[model samples]
Every structure is written in C-alpha cells, then in structure tokens.
Target: MDKHGNSYDKALDVFEKLLDEPLQKVLSGPLPLARAVGLATTSGYRAAAIAESEGLLSRSTEGDYLRGPSTRTIGLSALGFGEFALVAEPVLIQLRQATRLTAFLAVAGNSQCMIGPHSRGRGLTFAVPQAQYYLPSLPVLDDERLAEISLSNRHEAVAAQRAAIAAVSEREDRQCIVGVLLPGLHEAATDDLRAHLRKASDLLRTQSEKLT
Candidate 1:
C-alpha cells in the first residue's frame, strides 16, 4: 500500500480485471478464489471476504462473487473523460465481442476526436495513449478506414471498422463518435465497403439511440 492509503485503488484495479460482463447486468459468472489469492497477500478466502465486506465486490444470492455497487460507480465522477467512458462502456464491450475487433467511442471536437471507452477484438489490435487528444485518421484502402472527412466537419465513418457498429450519441454534453475495427474485412470494392459501413453505422446509431 502507498503512504497515502491507496489500497482501495489497488483493490479496484484487480476487481476491474475480473469483470467479463457489462456493469448494468448482473454477473452470472463466478471468479475462482485463486484469482484474488494470487494478488493479495492474504489467503484467497480472506481476500474475497474483505473485498465483499468493503463493497468492492458483491456476493450474489447464489453465493457467487460479482461486481459490487461500488465497482461501477468507482470513477464515474473522476473526470469528464471518465464519465463519458463509463456511460459508453457497455456499448463498446458488446461491439467488440460481436464484431471481433477493436472498438472505441470518441467525441468530435474542433478538427479532432476525443477518445473515450474502447475494446479489442480477437485479432491483432492497436492502442492509443490516454493522453492522446486527437484521433488517428486511418487511411482509406480496401477495408481499412471508415469515416469520410469533409470540409464542413460532418464526421461519417464505417461501422465495419467500428466492429459491432458505432454511432454518435445525441446528447448536449458532447458530440461523441463511436468506431469499431473490422477484421477479415478485406479486398472489397470501395463502393461495397461504403455500403457495408453505412449499414453498420446505422445499426450503431439505432443502438445508441435506445440507450439515450
């Protein structure tokens, strides 16, 4: 532990690594006791007991451990980026799982995109640093990049690149754009790619709309 008593922070890190489901859903999966014992100095049971007592983890009615109430709310208020990430997390996760690619939610600001929550697919994935303020503009080749940049700042992107589809959520807080990676989507004509991307983008828009 740090001199400032950051044990809770460490515990929070471990708990996040254990999650395999959306925070809004009840976790039906159970993590083995070994998962905690491997990290904490204490015994597995002791670690689990302490985590549960502190509300960092919850014990289900079936006696299995899952995400506690505190886990989802941990950093919701920490920063603007964090709040946006938390709100968009469930969508990004489901998108990655469904499409098998890297998924991210970002906001379009003056000539750039603000990165929010993101997830990786089964195939090779790339990452951007947290301090990155602008989004990377992937080149348009074959099934490579989505989102066409226009002179007016209208951001249009492909859902295939976005994986399970992504949309710009309609909200006053910020104009957010979502993107997903499309693996194995190669060697297609540009027109065909645009068609596919348009469909995917529409789907993502619909899904995000439902959430709002």
Candidate 2:
C-alpha cells in the first residue's frame, strides 16, 4: 500500500478533471484501466497506482479500478473538513480577517510544509495549496525572524515570512505554519510567503497536540 500521502493533491486534481467522464460512466460498470488513465490526462501510471493503494481507487476482480472509501475521506480532508483542517481553519480565518491579509495554515509533513486551510486578503491574486507541500532550502522553524509580527512592516523579508515562529509547530507535535501577510506587502512577498513563511507554528503545537 502507498503509505506516504505524497502527490495526493496532484492526483486529486487529475481525479477531479476526470470525474465528469469515466467516473460518471463507471457508476454503472467497472472502469477500464486504460480508460481511467486516459481520463487522467495529467497523471501518470505511478500516480494512478498511488491513488489506488491509498484507497482513492480499488481494483475489482476484473482488474478494473473503482472509487473507494478513501476517495471521500481524502476529498473531505482536502476541503478542510478533516480533523486537522477543521481545527486549524478557524484560526487561519481569524488571523486573516484580523490582519486583512493573506492568512494560510500549513502542516509539516515528510520534511516538507504541507499547505492546509487558508484565507485570502482583499485584492490577493495568488493562491497556496492545501494539498501540496513545499520543501524549502531551510526549515521554516530554523529561520531567525519569528515571534516578531511587527517586523514584517519593515524589511518585508524578516517581517514578511517570519519562518522562525512557524517552525515551532513542526517540532514535537503539530508542525504547522500560520501566515498573515500585511496589506502593504508587495509582489516580493510572494517569495517570502512561498519560500519562508511563519506564525502560529507554536500556536498549532500548543492548541493541537493530537495533530502530530
């Protein structure tokens, strides 16, 4: 079985793209492997296999793959309905509304930061994934600029991402990052947000110990 939940986001994207076709047809019959693959134009065989082993799909006696329990589980989880998301989304929303900035919640997984629930500020053009994870050159927690929320207004680098504080969540328990982008932050903040973002990594740890 595929133990790691890597590529789940991409695989799910492929799944959603194909849902209107084969998945609809398969409601009455077993979906052919090739047909399933054909529908997933962006996904590879390996990704399909991973989705299968993860319970997103199941091979029938005839070798056809069918939707399984994990599909719904993963879907709900992706939509921020899972235990971790449910607990974390509120905090993320609160932070965003409070700051009127882009607020995001990400969890640490596989040595990478797994993006989770998020809120967007007005005029925010970019988006972060709740499915994919980013492996920065250095850990978000290791950064020097954390715990100082006010610094973001100055250099935009130190105060911007503040990876140091977010890294705390990744320590012994729920390794998650909660970021709030200031209204004045510019496009450069994108790199900071993507490359080194932080906040509430410690809060997640304190609030949700079960997340680990």
Candidate 3:
C-alpha cells in the first residue's frame, strides 16, 4: 500500500477503537487519544486529526477525545440498527408501562451487558453509570442458552436489583439480550416480571426476524 493507504488504514483502526471503548467513559470525560488508538503521540494525533476533519471524533476542551455527532448519526442510521430500534421502541415502552419498571435492550457478552435503548420508570431507579455494566447475576453466554430467558439478582448500594433477561438471535451472527430492570428482588413479583419479559422478548424476536 502507498503512504496514503497506510494512513487511511490507521484512521480506520482509530475509529474501531473509538467504538470498542466503553461508551460511558467516552461520554464522561476526555480519553487519551494515543493510548486509545494504540499509536505513539505523534502518529495517534495525526490519525485523530484525520478523523476529526471527517467528524468521526471531537476533541474535548482539555484536549482529550470522544466520539463526535457523526458517530451517533451513523449508529442510529439505517447502516446501523435504527430500523431495529424503531420496531423495538414501542415494545420497550409497553413493557415499561405494563411492569412499571425500566425496560431495556442490550448486547450481552460473556459476562458484560452493553446497555442500549431503554425506557426509564418513575421513582428510584437503577441505571448503569456508563450504560454498560458487568452484572454478576447475568447468566453466562453459551450456545445452548442463546435463546433462553434467564432470571437473576444482584445487590448494589443496599438496594437489591432484579433482572429478567432473554437472549434471542438478532442476525445469523448476532444476538441481543432483552431485559427489564426492577428495583428489588421479591419472590411475589418474579412471576409478573417473567411473564412481561417473555412477552416482550417474543415480540422483539418476531420483529427482528423480518429485518434480516
């Protein structure tokens, strides 16, 4: 590849790292561009300048970096998952209304869950600091458990949180975890939460299939 080609490839890598980093930290404050892009200061700054010129990144007042407006536009654009969000938003709203709890959709990893679109409930609520979390209660990911609903609980700051998660296939190579966040863990409330989650998951799965 030519020199220009090399620069282009490095710029692409920077964008990938920008997306891969925890969104909460990205939004919270400035991040070290050199370390984030895995390049030396001079090279990383050069790559960042290229990305900034195209609106893929923005520099903080303190000279750190974060995702720019263009990134959100692309994320919600058709090229991303905007269509799925359109179909899922109504279901999420309904789930929130029915259960009076926060209803959310996330991309689940082995032990972490990346929070996505969500409907917040009234009163005291539990939300992720950075919209991504490592919930110890979340079931481990496995081929056999990919499409099954899992229920679990974890305590945070004296309040017990209960979650009902249903992992379903989103695409041939992707899957999503649809879930609800409740304030407390109560045996009496588990049944209702499970029922609502099951219904919502079914709607999401059915709607997701049509998109593919």
Query: Which regions in candidate 2 have their CA more than 4 angstroms from the true location?
Result: 1-83, 108-112, 124-134, 140-165, 171-174, 181-203, 210-212
Whose lDDT is greatest here?
3
Candidate 2 matches the true fold with a TM-score of 0.39
TM-score of 3: 0.50
The better-scoring model by lDDT among 1 and 3 is 3
Model 2: ten consecutive residues of lowest lDDT:
147-156
lDDT of 1: 0.47
CA shift at 120, candidate 1, in angstroms? Answer: 1.6
Query: How would you encode candidate 1's per-residue C-alpha lDDT over 66-178 as one tens digit per residue?
Result: 65545544532232233443345566666556555566665554444544456655646553223124334422322433554321122444322322223344344444555
Model 2 root-mean-square deviation: 11.9
Tell me how far the alpha carbon of residue 186 in candidate 3 is from the true structure, in angstroms, after superposition: 6.1
Query: Against the unseen true structure, what C-alpha lDDT does each candidate score?
Result: 0.47, 0.47, 0.60
Estimated TM-score per prediction? Answer: 0.39, 0.39, 0.50
RMSD of each: 9.5, 11.9, 8.3
